[model samples]
Target: MSDGTGAPVLLRTDGRAAHLVLNRPRALNALNHEMVLRLGEALTVWESDPAVETVVLTGAGERGLCAGGDIRVVHADARDGDGSASAAFWRDEYRLNARIARYPKPYVAVMDGIVMGGGVGVSAHGDVRIVTERSVIAMPETGIGFVPDVGGTHLLSRAPGELGTHLALTGARIGAADALLCGLADHYIPSAALPDLLADLAALPVADAVARHARPAPGGDLAAAREWIDACYRADTVEEIVRRLLDHGDPAAKEAAETLLAKSPTAVKATLAAMRRARALGSLEAVLDQEYRSSLAGLGTHDLVEGIRAQVVDKDRAPRWSPATLAEVTDADVERYFARLGARELGLAGETGEPGAPGAAD
Candidate 1:
């Protein structure tokens, strides 16, 4: 479908750089199924085209690269229809995420604005992820009663120490430096220099073009809080983690505890589970398969519907999560999210059975 300017995703080639501009700026370039299909189709074509040396992804407006998936649609689907549409969207979207990770050519993501949820899926997996001072990246699904999907768990679970756990539970937004420290972004480019950088990409090799504009990232908050973050978030359970956070005597830690408490209880618990499982799942593809299970499971739950209504539809900012409190979210409740899906599986990992396989407001 058109986002007025063109397809939701606009594809073009300038010199050697193939560009995919996410066109839904009115919604901060929010991704829908049509955009996902367009992206996959473009990549498939570019992979075979001799002229396309690199794929560059950027969002249309100043707000950000992408706010996330077209979640308003997902909310409507869950509320008004059987979830097959949402499920199909995710199936293709996750495949596209994996494709970017494993893309034969260099894939550059211009993450200059708000990159969250599904936005992170598309960008962070790329060969080159460029973040600017304007970037605010997050994986905030827990707040809306959803588990992180599109390989988010794989990326977060692999982040140093307990930082990923902290991020997953709190649904926090991090800046460029924090993103780099967390292993989310590769290069830093000033937003002002982006126009010049794009011009260089058309003529120069990907690395050379990026190096011309990339600079050392400025420092950010996550580094200073690492000691407490590592110590408090190392717990085996979400309850224990919150207990540690509250008792740590650090105001930041206490605030984190409050944030965790405020999110959807079941989502928080299940997200914690997803992060931990993602670490042991061996490869990115395996973790994505696991995430598919978790995503579909969350799709069928009460909290998912209510959380969206409160956060998006009603704009209340107060989600009344089912099971209410973390204590009420039982082990079984969280485990249900990881249950297998058999024939409905994403099967990306299983396609080649190979290793070396490849979120924020995310």
Candidate 2:
């Protein structure tokens, strides 16, 4: 199976399995627009192919499975209001994520290293999620003034109690065992054995590949800290949550609270609302659509610009958030984010090769 651009998916077929190795190690295989399109195309082909019984997705290096989207470009586009360009990236990326969720063929991801943000988007939704001791999974979007997109709400909401909300708001990192506990991974194997597993996957039949790659017993107890997480994050607003964390008298909880408070207040509130709504009412597609709306509209807002400026553009870590307190964020503000845009739609993609061509109009 060749990538449409001839860059190659590094595709190799054994008896009944195929392997898709993400090749751009330089940037940790971050999802550029082209890579996103290629992945969607590759998966579409494999889904229809009779001989392909299962597929394995992995990254190129020790750095990570992926570091998320190519945010440098996204930042540029955001500043320029490059909707025509950026919209294609998000639409196709979201479609690929949704496809992964619904894919029939058994899919596996070798989460060998750092798996954060968009990295979680691509692999976490697979049929068989594998993690190694090297795995470092996180949804680190709030730190950047962005909501966790890539169907993050679907997985995060399903996590124990408010841990999902805590992680989304705080952008905390979870190790392999903790990720497994959160239902993000199905197996745990030693990172040293990934090569052997890959070799087995590349040479053996689909069933044999799965058999050879069978993981060791899952490790550690991630649920031990669940009581603390739920307690610290249960408060209604960011300020309240911070106060609760401080009162808990746990050093880690206090540190997390301070870090979260330093982030954009509006982003924190909007993300919490998104997660809450995601739990009760929407499918992943609907969630991503809502996220896209927030992201699109957020670019012009104060937090996003300040966030990018403080975190990425300028080395200084101070961000001046508008309505800087959670108390300042109202239900009306949150609801306005979800309210229908007058005559506006995210205009999706179509099967045509021309990427910008919009899908059926809303």
What TM-score goes with each of the models? 0.97, 0.87
Candidate 2 versus the native: TM-score? 0.87
Summarize candidate 1's per-residue lDDT along 280-304 as a digit string, tens digits. 7767888887788888999899999
lDDT for position 172 in model 2 = 85
- In model 2, the number of clashes is 0
Q: Residue 118 lDDT in model 2?
A: 82
lDDT of each: 0.90, 0.75
Judging by lDDT against the true structure, name the best candidate. 1
lDDT of 2: 0.75
In model 2, where do residues sit more than 4 Å from their true spots? 1-9, 203-222, 342-362
Candidate 2 lDDT over 317-360, as tens digits, reads 88788778778978776665555444444432223221322332
Q: Taking the candidates one at a time, how many backbone clashes does each contain?
A: 10, 0
